[model samples]
Target: MLLKTFRWAFAVTALGLVAGVLYDGWTALGLVAILAVLEVSLSFDNAVINAGILKKLNAFWQRIFLTVGILIAVFGMRLLFPIVIVAVSARLSPSRAVHLALTDKDRYQELVTDAHPSIAAFGGMFLLMIFLDFVFEDRDVKWLSWLERPLARLGRVDMLSVCLALIILLVSSMTFAAHAHQHGGGHADKAQTVLVSGIAGLITYLVVSGLSDFFESRLADEESTKSDGAGRPAVALAGRAAFFTFLYLEVLDASFSFDGVIGAFAITNDIVLMALGLGIGAMYVRSLTVYLVRQGTLDDYVYLEHGAHYAIGALALILLVSIRYQINDIVTGLIGVTLISASFYSSVRRNRAARE
Candidate 1:
C-alpha cells in the first residue's frame, strides 16, 4: 500500500531526473533532488492540513485535485505565473516573456523580480482567501475559535487578518517603492505598474473571496436543508466547521507553497526544475494528508488541528515579516518546521496520554 501510494512520486522523480540530465546534466539533477527534499521538509505541516481536507472530499474532486490541481501548481502558477508577472511589469507580451525565460535566462530573474509586486499579489490574494475562510466561519467542532475571538472583537469579521494584509501593503509600498525609485525613472514606471498590480491583486482577492464565501454559504444552506435526516454527515463533514476546515487546508497549502514558490526562483529558473522540486514536495504533502486521514491523526490528537492553525497564523505573520527582513528561506523553513514538529510531538504525547 505504501509503495502504491508513492509510485507516482517515484515515477515523477525518475522522470524529472531523466529530464534534468538531458537538459542540464547530472549536477542539475542532483540539485533538483536536493531542492525537492528541502521543499518537502518545509511543507510537512501543509501535508497534515491537506490530509484533513482530502479525507472529506469526494473521490472525484480528489482525483481532480491530484491531477489537474497539480498541473495548476506546476505549470500555471509556478511557470506561467512568473512569466505573466514579467510581462505585465516589463510591458512585454506573454509569449515574448516566456521566450525570455528560455533564451536570455540571465535576464529571466531580472524581469521576474521586477514584478515582485505581482508575485506578492498572487500569493497574497490566495493567502488572504485562506485567512478569511478559516477565521470567519462559525463551527460546532472548532479548534481555533479560542484564538479567533479577540481577533474578531477587533471586527465581527476576521478584520485582523485583513488589517495585517493592509499593513503589509503599506509597508511593502513604503520600503520597496523607495528602493524601486532609487533604481531610477526608466524602471520607475514599471515599478509603479508592479505596485499598482499588487494593490489590484489585493482588491481582486477581496472580491473573489467575498463571492466564493457567498456561494459556498448558499450551497451549504441548500445542502443542509435537504439533509433533513437525524445524524450529521457520518464523516463529520457536514457543518460550518468542516467547510472551514476544507478552506483552511487549501489556504494553508497555498501559504506553505508561497516560500517554496518564491524561493524556487533562487534555484535554476528552469520551469522544469521549479515543477520537479516543488512537485516532489507537493507529492509528499498529498501523501502525508492521506497518512493522517488513514491514521485519524486529527481526531485522535485533538489539539493537533489547533496547533496547525496556530502555525498557519504564525506562518502568515512570518511571511509578512519576511517582506522586509528578506529573512533567508532556510530560516523561514526551519521556523515553520519547528512549530509544526512541536505540534506533532505534542499531539503524540496527548495521544499516548489518552491511551494510558
Candidate 2:
C-alpha cells in the first residue's frame, strides 16, 4: 500500500535529482536535496490539514489534486508566484521580473524579501482565521479539552472568530507601526499595507470557506434524501462542493508556501533548483495526504486534526511575528513536528488504554 501510494513521489524525486545534476552538477544536487527535505519538514502539518479536506472530495477531484494541483503548486506557487510578487512589489513588468530572477538573483532575492511584510500579513491572517474557526467551532471530540471547551462556548456568539481575527490584525498592524517608528523609519505606509493585506486575507478566507461550506451543506441536504443500500448518504463531495473544496485546498497550499518560497533563498537563489526540490517535496505531501485518507488515519487517531490545527495556529503567529522579527526555519519546522509527534503519542496511549 505504501509503495503504491508513493510511487509517483519516488519517480519525481529521482527525476528532480537528475535534473539538479544536469543543471549544475554535484553542488546543485546537494542544494536540491536540502531544499526538498526542508519543504517536507515545514509542510507536514499542511499534509494533515489537506487530508482532512481532500477526503471529502470525490475520486475525480482527488486525481485533479494530484495531477493539475501539482502543476499549479510546483510551477505556479514555487516559481511564478515569487516572480509575480517581485513584479508587483517592485513595479516591474513580468518580463523584467523574470529577467531579474535569471540575471540578478541577489537583487531578485532582495525584492522578494522586501515584499515579505505584505505576504506574511496576508498569509498569516488567512491561516489565523482557519485556526480560529477550528478552535471556536463546537465539536464532540476535543483534543485539548481544557482550552477548546471554553473557546467552543465563546464561539456560540456569531462571527466571534471574525471579530477576534480582525482585532488581532489591528494589534499586529499597530505593533508593526511601533516597531518601525522605533527603528526610525516611516510607519504609515508599512502599517497601512499590513492592515490592507490582512483584510484581503480575511476576506479571501471568508469567501472561499464560506462558499465551500454553503455548497457542501446543500449537497449534504440533497444527498441525505437518498441513501445507499446500507442506508447512509453518499459522503463523497461532488459538483460545486468539490470545486470549491479543491479551490480552498489550493489557496491553503499557496498560503503555506509563502514562507518556504522566500526562505529557499537562504539555501540557494537558483529558481530552477528551488522549483525542482520543492516540487518533489510537494509530491510527497500529496501522496501522504492520499495515504492518510485511504488508511482512515484521522478516524483512528482522533487528535491528529487537533495537532495540525494547533501547528497552524503556531505558524500563523510565527508569520505575524516575522513581519517585524526574523525566525529560524528550523524553529518553525521543529514546533510543528513536535506538536504532531506529541499528538501521535497521546493517540497511542488512548488506544492502549481502551484495549486494556
Candidate 3:
C-alpha cells in the first residue's frame, strides 16, 4: 500500500529534479527538495481533514478530486493565487506582479510580507472556527475527554465560537495597532485593516457552510424521491451535489494553501521556484488523501481526526500571534506534527487494549 500510494510522488520528484536542474542548476534542485519537505510536513493534518470530507463523496467525485482537483491545487492555488495576492495588494496588474516576481524578487517579497498581517488575520480566523466548531460538537467518540467534554458543554451557548473569535480579534488588533503606533506608524489604519480582514474571513466561513448544507439537504431529498418513485431522475441531483462538494473542497484547500504560500517566501523569494517546489508537495498530499480514504485509515484510527483538529487550533493561534511577532516556521511545523503523531500513538495503544 505504501509503495502504490507514493508511486506518483516518486515520479513527480524526478520530474521536479530535472526541471530544477534545467532552470537553475543543482542548487535549484536542493531548494525544491527542501520546499517539498516543508509543504508535506505542514500539511499532513490537512490531508486527514480532507479524508473526512472526501469519504462522503461518490466514487466519481472522488476521482474528480484526485484528477481535476489536483490541477486546481497545483496551478490554481500554488501558482495563480500568489500572483493574484501580489497584484491586488500592490495595486498592480497581474502582468506586473509576474514581472516583478521574475525581476525584482526582493521587492516582491517585501510587498508580500507587507500584506501578511491581513492574510494572517483572514486565514487564522477561518481555521480557528473550524477547530472550535469540531471541538464543541457533541460526539460519541472522545479523544481528549477532559478537555473536549468541557468544550462540548460550552457548545450549548448560541454563537459561542463567533463571539470568542470576535473577542480575540478585538484584543489582538487593538493591542497590535497600539504597539505599531508607539513607533510613530498609523495606529487606526492598522486596526481597521485587521478588523475588516478578520470579518471578511468570518463571513466567508458562514456563507460557504450555509451553501453546502442547503445543497446537501436538496440532494438528500432528491435521493429519497428517486428511491420512492423509481426512476433515473436523480442523476441531475447527483451532479448538483457533486458541484457543491467540489466548491467546498476547493475553498478548504485554498485556506490550507494560504500559510504554505506565505511561508515559502521565507525559504526562497523566487515565485516560480516556490510554485514548482510546492506544487510537487501538493500532488503528494493529494495522493495521501486518496490513500487514506481507500485504506480506511480514519476508521482504523478514530482519534486521528481529533488530533488533526488540535493541530489546526495550535496553528491558528500561531498565525494570529504572527500578526505582531515573528514566529519561527520550524516551531510552527513541529507543533502540528507532534500533536498528530501523539494522537496516532494513543490510537494504537487503544486498539491493543481492546484486543486484550
| Top candidate, metric lDDT | 2
Clashing residue pairs in candidate 1 are: 51-289
Candidate 1's residue-wise lDDT over 26-128, tens digit each?
8878878877887886676677667666767555556655676666666665566677767876789999988888888768777665555445544554554
For every model shown, the clashing-pair count is 1, 0, 0
For residues 133-204, what per-residue lDDT tens digits would candidate 2 score against the true structure? Answer: 999999998888999999999999999999999998899999963474222236777888889999999999
C-alpha RMSD of each candidate structure in angstroms: 4.3, 1.8, 3.2
After superposition, candidate 1 runs with Cα above 4 Å error: 128-160, 176-216, 225-231, 234-256, 322-324
Residue 329 displacement in candidate 2 (angstroms): 0.3
Deviation from native of the Cα of residue 276 in model 1, angstroms:
2.8
Error of 3 at 176 (Å): 3.3
Tell me the TM-score of each prediction against the true structure: 0.79, 0.97, 0.92
lDDT of 3 by residue, 288-337 (tens): 99899999999999999999999889888887788788788788889989
Considering summed lDDT, which 10 consecutive residues are worst modelled in model 1?
A: 231-240
lDDT of model 2 at residue 151? 95
